[model samples]
Target: MTACDQARELQRIIDQQLISTMFQPIVDCQKGTVLGYEVLSRGPSDSPLHGAPALFQAGEQCKQVISLEQACLLEAGQSCIRHGVSHLVFVNVSPGLLLPKAFAEDRLQSLLATNGLKPENVVIELSERYPADNPEALKARLTALKKRGFRIAIDDLGTGYSGLKLWSEIQPDFVKIDRHFIRDVDRDLVKKEFVRSVINLCERLGCRLIAEGVETVAELTLLRSMGIHLIQGFLLGRPNPFPTAELSALDNPDPIGGGQATSDAGYLGRYIVPLAPTASLGEAWQVLQSSPSIFALPVVDNDRPLGLLHKWRVMEVFSSTYGRALNETKPVSSLTAYDALVVEHDESLEAVSQSLLEDDLHYLKQHFIVTRNGHYIGLGSTRSLLRMMTRSRVEQARHANPLTQLPGNVLIQQEAVHRLQQNNPFTCIYFDIDHFKPFNDLLGYSKGDEVILSLARQLCTVFNGDSEWVGHIGGDDFVVFSDRLEIRKRCEEVQQLFALEAATRYPEAIRQAGFITGEDRDGLPRQFPLVALSAGIVVADSRAFGSAADLAATAAVAKSKAKKAVSGIQIVSNIAALNEMSDDHKTTLLA
Candidate 1:
């Protein structure tokens, strides 16, 4: 058959949109909620008349393939709007197909706006298994898209020629974790570290990191432990033709943040409350009155969380030298739960409750702290565990997004200040979601959240609580304290891991891999330009500063250096760096 003759026949099917668009729901693996869907082009049945390959194979190569991609994007965009797609809608394309001048930005915008979508709501993915397309063309289009509120991603990285070239070429907002690194992530340190580096880079450069092909609970647990706040995998939800669940509605539609939200679909399980050891005798009494089973209230001041009045500890206090004044005595750590354990709020209630049950009988601590990141939310006691577990379910049903479960800012500041007062070594990691706002704007908050949660999970693993405490300071910013010695190394680890994860999770770079871009901030042509990351590492040590404010300022300075230095970790090891940057100008300018 003649090419044109065959093209006419293929065009009939392409025009019909017969190719059933397959969907893979992106989920917050840590929270077990659907966050978004990736649109995949599939064929109806097995016939050549219905297959994407068949249509393209029949003289539909360049023009037809490009047309088909546009069609799929338009369709997916419509689906997101009609279904209130809370999560991102990922649409895949190939560089070979997309780099053509035909893939115009203005035309695409018009099509999307027609479907109630903007450049911000879609994450354009590359379907190929290699790096980059025409360097100049991809950059030209992607930059234009970004300016218009669109975000770019590199899909299925680590499976092909995904390398530094691709990454430097197209600084994508989201990096899809190829199944290779995701499989057995819980068991593989290499994989864990690899993904962590990507997240680190994401945090530094304002990019979003996402893991693809996640299929196991262990993987989910590992990611959650690493501090990843979002995820996607079969363990959470499967994709459907339509958006089937509510995963958002929790994001601040307005500029402000934080509010009480709950859900009925899942239980919050029981969140633990930390009692101040020296809670004025009156406060302790009040807490006990509100909760009779509160055998102890955490005694917390500016230092670490301390214990409350243990049944036996209380008796011991009365029998001591000052037995008569025991009731009014200064709160002591004696009543505290030694080695108090913590579970993230996004975790499964069943597993956490079971753990509590197993340890309750022989428990040294009477409460469990329910936390998101590392900030405390509330206290979960043995008595309230049951009731609160049910209540948690209501919270989950009421609110769709599980990525954010912590109470909010007031608690975040308390946690930060508390760590500072402890005088222990801590690592302050000022995490910025490389291009998170743009990515979120492009893919939707749900998918953006998936990236956030994923990074949180990665950091938790790398920054696991030591004397080194890790906590979310809000938004994309996070901190970690490792008792002095390891604090510096830990910060470096976060930096490296972030870059690697960003490479893997974003497909735009992978598809744009071997290409090069020459552009300035103004979009004018330039020389060998590309996008990457900048991270600042500040170690919480005596030489650096004594207060949280000082530590934060030093850290912020170091972070600026990292961002400006291109690659490599910058540690504020001395007062000189801090000294050189004082407000009063005690130092002379180097002429």
Candidate 2:
């Protein structure tokens, strides 16, 4: 369409309120739940301005950007209400539209009220895409919005002009890292460092940081390891008119901290009745006085958790001569400890422990509230958390491999059994170093240990995802468990990486010669090829195998076949056919 036609179409879109809103979930990776949904506006599919860029560009050209944004905001609110979305709704707004003259505060409030939404439940996300001419004025306007109970977020952080300056001045409650920084973050060291700095800054500023546009599990895994809990991306979910509050992609059986079954904090929580936010201080004091064991009482409104009320704080007020009479009738919410750490029940114990260590010492002596999907569940004590941490550390040390510090055979067996019980299709890879004994004999045991550790590191780097696990079966033998279907390609990458890494450990001449002179088991001289990797891959497609031992036996057969292959990789897809092979045939195959 021509420029004039585009402007007319844009005007018609704004006038008729033809804009449609699609909601994309922003997930809390640690909790494996959706924290909120960001509202995305798009023009009608049949129009030339169907995409956001074309629609907004036309608005800017026609000088109807403010009107277009207003329509989008109203449509988003209506959609949210219609969909009965109770979680936070993040609506994008241009920086220019945040000005008092461009968008009136009363009108904004009226829009929220009309949709049956509260200011606290709606986040006004201002994109740094449009830099403000007068930041001080914008800051003043944002302050006014904050005072009115609206949360502010800066979108596309680090990509627009004056990102850090705007972040410092506004001090938004949330900041979303642009997609540029999130894409291939696992491979790019500079992007990783930049994100790490952003994470630290957000923590120090007491602001929530979200990593946007996570398209791959590698990026998701790396971001989660860096302490980024909130994430948004096409990998998790796509934008839709109606989106589910929970994402199955985030439901990782083995999360970043560890396995979810043992690492979740919900197991540590004890049931403690919560105090209503409307309860008076006098009533709260009575509750605390009656229950001397309760150190902190959760303040809950409906099913939602507001904050916590410490017994000590409440007692101090009541102890004073005039304090009781002056504040006894006030609501308990007035004394709510907003800063108390509130964690989701599914949050890993390791993550919760990190949060505690980062906070003041006072938290060490008190209790933290636990919630499930933002609803009050129970209270968890620091004493219990510390005790659990100690036990976990002891168990891990007992089961971990000494050389590489990876999981040992006992844990490896348990992991295999767990995957089998889950009955999900997965790949079990057994990795063996070819001619490792000869290499150790020629290059000493200490140098041999270096190769093992290097191989362990490579396995970790290549299989670093939520569903991937690497374990050491002792010596130069390691095993990998992964849910990815593309195990063959990943195995190829591992072989290529190990080949390069193994070459570095050999002498210059030995490397070029492609062989090392070493004594054979018969005490005779032989030519051993420089260390190479041999991988045995078994794709488990069903519950045909009863136990880990049975699977291990099949994997052993596969390994024997791999050792005799030229490519050093063998895959066994049919367990029944492999089992039917005679012992003599297997021996011949290995030979």
Candidate 3:
């Protein structure tokens, strides 16, 4: 369409309120819950300005950005209420509109009232794309909005013309890192460091940071590891007019970083009274003075954590010449250590440990903030984390197989029981060597050890993943637990690879003949086939098994059947099938 035509269309959209608002979920990855929705406005579907870029471009051309934003705000609030969305609603506002004279406070209040929304429920998101001509006036107007209970956020933080200056002056309640920094963040060191710096800045400023435009699970996993829980992206959900308030039930619902197991670290947390970020250093000193044992105080704003304020740092500042007079009334946020480690209470101990080790050494002696769903819960010391980890490692080592270093029977049962409780479908594969006693006689015990190690390596190689586990069940038997549907194909690969490995252990004559002569248990000489793999697979979902013991017993039964089969592989959907089958019945074979 022509520029004039687009301008006319934009005018009509604003005048008639023809804007359609789509809600994109902003999820709290740690809690697996929706924190809120970001309202995305689009022009009418049939118009040339249907997409946001074209729509907003036309508004800029027509010099009606303020008017367009007002319409969008009103439409967003009404749509949110209509959809029964009571969660926090984030609405985008132009920086130009934040000027005191450009936008009226009563108009905003009236808009919220008409839509049944309170000031605290709405977050006015200002994009830094267009720098404010008069920042002092904009700050004054934003202060007024803050006084009225409305929260402020800076959108597309790094992509704007005015970057740190805007953040420093505004001290927004939330800051959204632009998508450029978030894309490929898992693989990009520079991007990771940049985001880490942004996180630190937000913590020091007592602002909540959000990562935008995350499209891959890798990106999500990495961001979660770095202490960013609030996520917005297509990976979670796309924008829709009627978006679901919650995420769909996933087999692996939580985004765990570093392939760490899910375990709550809440027990290590100690509740401490947090100081407001706006509180003065003098106020903090008094509190630190009263609590002699407390080393640091968390700086919080509206229940959201900013960072930790250490006592030594405060004393050093106060002890400086003329420090008391110059810095007594300054906000505690200025002295807060933004780099203090913050972890969700549900984070795995291993994941938290990895994060701690990766941080600077100074953090080793510092207290880390522990939060539940991004809200401050308490503080956890490094000493406590290390102590717990030491205990956990000792227990894990006790249950690990000595030779293969895989989980022993106790851990295997624990893993199976954990999967069963989650109610997610998983597969268990039982593997045993065929004619192993005869092979052991033909080859010395030393050679037999090599064969066993080969199989263990193959199983580990095949089943290595975040949701896959390998266990040594003693002797020549091994078991694998996997959530993958293609696990049978992997089992076949292991069988093929083991066949090659088995040939290496045999003499040339025996390898060529594909058989070895050895004394049987009765002392009679018999010819046994070359050592081969026998695998039995059980795919479990909601079947009623009494315990992990019963599951293992069923897998053992399947392995017995597989030993008699020509293809050397057997699969059953559940234990009922095996129980119903007679001794003469042939087991199900994988195609």
Candidate 4:
């Protein structure tokens, strides 16, 4: 069709309000919950302008792009209201719609208000495909929109040079990585690295990332490991007129890959909120004003935190003679509190707090800067640091088993409960030494304790990570938990290693015979098989169980079966029937 024909058709469609809106969920991959939905526009199903690309292309051609954009915005708003969507609704806005002539700054706010929505509930997603002639002016307009409470997102990131430039300039609250890079990301290490870098960059900028066009579980799982929690695409949920979150996509939980949790359970990223190194003191002042309770702000350039800006220091300067005029326009780095502590996100909170307490940098202790990969994220307060340190010490002392120096059942239960509440899928393995009592009786309690310590050391070697946990439930009974896909394989490896150690720990006679002479419980002489490890594993499904007690119960039943099998792994899952390990028991080294 000619531009004239297309324009006429577009006009007719607009006058009749023939556009349709669909929603696709952007899920929180970590929590297995819906974060929000991105509003997608479609023309009449049978029309030539059906898809957003075609519809908007025709609008651009007919010089009616602004009109089409407005229609989409209104339709999206109404649809969200009709569906009673309380979560954030992401709406696509053309740069043309931001023009002084075509754009009304309050248009969206008014439309959302009519639909019982607020500006905060809407995220304006602008594609880089359309470049504005004056980037600075466009940013200014977006800044105005931000002040009015709307969140901005750069859509299809990495698809255009302008997008990258816009990202650096605007520092959007969210960035949607284009599907091209996300496609088959799991299989492509380069893509994974690229995405990982973006995830890290987002963290530094304090921006949340949404991986768009995720089409496979592999891609989804890979993104989750990289700390990209917000996700979108067909793999998560297809866009539909009446959309619902496809939480089932999160059933396959993968191990979180950052690193081990430090003492005091704190990381620097949790405490950092950074300002650009070039940002003026006035800008820093505004930041402090907005977050009235914040004490300090980190000044950073390219992910590297240069120094901190304390609220009191800023106030002191502004209150001084001509101080406001002297510093308001100067770079935040000029007046930053260099004495404030700077620490990496992975650093032990305990060590950081100790360092701070020893320094005596300031009389009024407040907050410290936190960095991940050298980029500033936010500030951590002294109060939080002290509280976390005290809690960690108390919990460690109270829950550690004195015998093995490992966490006791209480810690294990607490860990299980926390994972359950997060709906994080994992495997729980209950391990008990087969014929342990006979060996303990033969060797005596002190020797038995030595064997137990050896086992504990073996466990520590296998499950030494933040995502994996090990606990001594007492005596020969132990529990292991992991949210990794390789949990089963890891369990088998542990068993093999344990079997070898078990054979070695016994006397030469017992090793050669593969059995030891011991008196049965009734005081009858009998030959007992050499010690072996039995593991009963309960795999958590996507949906959490009733409680940690439910998980323990399930694991207990599986353990019974495993023990009956003599020396092998037994697996059960809440979502499926009981599953037993393959008949191929490891090498039959013992019994």
Candidate 5:
């Protein structure tokens, strides 16, 4: 169809109000409740201009966009009322329609009033499809809407060219991240960082962030962990013509960051306070004076942190002749140290400390900002970080095994107990040197110590990235535990690596014979095989074990069976299965 025909079609849809409104829920992930719905308008399904993009394009060409948008707003409000949706309704509005004079007297407000919808119940989602004709005019209109109790949201943030600048100017009450950023946030570190940074920025700016287009459980979980409570996506609930304002339940939801325990090496959430970016230097001075203990304050706009304001720096600025008069009235954000150290609340305290130390020494005096997602949670002093590190080192020393430096019995038990509560599938492999005591006596304790250290390093290297735990249960006994499916392959690799290392470490005569003559107890000389590995693996069943101790006992039984076998590898399904295996099969090992 020609542009003219498409224009006529758009006009008819607008005049007759034939647009279809689909209500997609915006959920509060943490609370597990539906916060509101985003009103998405569709043109007549039978028409060529059915999708939002096509219809808007047609309207754009025909100079009827304002009319089309107004019509959608009217219909969306009525549709919400008809559907009994009492929550906040978000409607997309083009940037072109944001002129101050036009919005001050626009029929959009009147249409909402007719449907019994107040400005507070409506959220004007400023679309980024078209650039603003006049930014100042748009800001003026948005400011007026805000004053009238209407909530403003900047839509498709991060994907748009002018989103940051627009955010800085208008400081919307909410910001919707574009689908591109949220598409695979769970798997993409870059996207995670981007979203995290956006979240922080939103917190500093005092703006609510809504993740758009969340399509997977991983994505939803990651967003929730990052402190993003408001989410909209197909994974939660798809947009429908008739939608209910009810949150769908998520299964087995993990805490933020997968319940990964925080090391004592990170900053806490005690020092964070909300300071406006537009606050005057005088206001900043008053804040610093009131809170004499804090070294810095995080400067923010709309709960999204911009940077930090150091008390010393501010005082230094004001100490200069005429400095107070020259800059007192200026926004505190203008003087904020944008490069001040900013770290997530979950970041390793050591990592944050190292970054500060490695950076220009000047930043040491500037207190670091601690944020959850991107919003300012508090300020962490360099002194506090150093203190935490000292305590962490002491704790590490207490938990680490002396021989191999791996975690000892206490920490190992703690790790096992934590996994038991999670109830995820996992395998635990318990292994020990086959003839460690005899070898230790024959080769002297020094050589035996080397072998134990070598095995520890091998275990750590093999299971390093699987989120698995390697622990020394003391003596020659060590365990490799993981929920990864490849644990079987890793166990084999460990056995093979130890075999090769053992062969290489022996003298020429011992290497050739694969055995050594050593004096056994009672002064009797005997032939003993070279050092070998014995591993017993248990694939846990949630139904079988009530405690970590029960699981450990079952794994010990499996280990004993593996030790008796000449080849030294035994895998059992569970504690019950370990008892059921025949004597011959239980002793059999992987080739």
Candidate 6:
């Protein structure tokens, strides 16, 4: 059939029994489980417009919009029982389809009971494709539905016209992100950042976002990295004519990929672990330990995700300046907003890719929240981003050294100075790499050069991709310009990545040479058979120190104090950021 003919033919069928149901799963990016399925429609077989959307659009053109919607809803309600699908059934209703007669004439709840369900279990998704001709009438009809315990949702957020306006008029319980927004989100930085902004906006407006149309493992991970809670995509599960036993499978490893599949492909599948709004810092810390990769967790009540917790920041309060106050803290979200990304299942992948792209540029803390019909379900992240974030900053500091090819004193010092200058800040930072007269003596200048080179490469990749600047001071020392706010975090990151890389990159000769020549901190053989580096962080940032040399001298005091601290990153960030913090804050608030 011609496109025109096919379109007409499809409408005729949706008005009849040809409206078949297709289920897509919503996935949780955090626990990687399925939460539920969203029901979409399929047109008659052999029709050129077999997809539900096209079929419904055809109905509208033919003035049988109500008939098409009726068929789809009937199928959804009946299928809910035929398939024994106990999860919420999401059926799309165009804005043009909600007639005033819906309240007094139609008994939707009674129609639903014929399929063995309640109004609350059936989520009526309202599509924004049709402009609201009379918004008040629409509101009155929806208010009646609300009285009947029906949950309303706004479909295709970000793609629709005036999504915020519709949201205000309808006050939907959930908002499904358009499929176009979630497609191939893994590689794109701009789209993800944009979606993240939407997530933040939702927080202000009190709406939940469910990301839709996830296909690849990478895309799923990308959404999670950005703190998106709920998701739905082909990678999660696909709709089946009948209920599949695989929806609840938790321990099953996907044959296609080693990761576990919590749900069959396309139906809502995501694992959710709940957190209270007033949870203590100790509790948050425990959760952090349990899931190291997760930088934030959704704070929820019953089924609603209320806010978020910053995993890294919470830990900082205890060990840093707020040590005594750490235990007194409750729910990290009290201080930090758990703004989450939300999208719906059954969306086009192209849209998803765009959102992920935007997120890459949004903030340093990257994570995406996924939702189904605006209900909290999962999260998304870019794998590459997580790897970069978790990488050791200390080893990176070592590698940052400009002279020896490791991150040296200069870069480390700058970070320290930046910390002192931070507004909430207190002091200075000291950057140190170990004095290496012996390694040069034992391994010859060439091997020493190789060591420096490896460290340098690691450092470059760490700072170059994520932050603005890092400098190198000569030999075994590095400086990082940082605000006092997250000083040790910067240090710890360097330490972890440095230790890991040092183990991996060092030559076999260094591993087994058995020369008994290096400095020993505890008199025990070091894992790589060498002493570890020491860093002293003094929190001071002052432009009065005209040259890098002066900064080096100031760092020297902190470094001496760190000799006792030993083999760890220390931050004296309290001193530095007075000027820098004001500059940064002014720039940030103004922008």
Top lDDT hit: 2
lDDT of 4 by residue, 74-139 (tens): 788888889899998898887767866456687767765565789888899989878787777788
Candidate 3, pairs of clashing residues? none
Candidate 4 TM-score versus the reference: 0.45
Clashes of each: 96, 0, 0, 9, 22, 169
TM-score of each: 0.39, 0.49, 0.51, 0.45, 0.48, 0.43
Tens-digit lDDT track of model 6 for 466-507: 222445565555544433334566566766766665544445
Q: What's the lDDT for residue 146 in model 2?
A: 87
lDDT of 2 by residue, 467-574 (tens): 799999999999999998668888889999999998998889999899998889899999999888999998875566766766787787788789899999999865
lDDT for each candidate structure: 0.56, 0.82, 0.80, 0.76, 0.77, 0.58
lDDT score, candidate 2: 0.82
Global local distance difference test of model 6? 0.58
Per-candidate RMSD vs. true structure? Answer: 27.2, 19.1, 15.1, 12.9, 14.4, 22.0
For model 1, residues 430-515, the per-residue Cα lDDT tens digits are: 55555444444434677666666666776777766534444455666555545554454655576566656644444576336622
Residues 407-509, model 5: lDDT tens digits: 7776676566556756777888898888676677767788888888899999999888635889999888998778874566778789999989867767888
Lowest summed lDDT window (length 10), candidate 4: 582-591
- What's the best-to-worst order under lDDT? 2, 3, 5, 4, 6, 1
Which has the better lDDT: candidate 3, or candidate 4?
3
Residue runs of model 5 more than 4 Å from their true location after superposition: 1-267, 357-366, 417-428, 464-469, 481-484, 504-528, 538-551, 564-567, 571-591
Best by TM-score: 3
Ranking by TM-score: 3, 2, 5, 4, 6, 1
TM-score between model 3 and native = 0.51
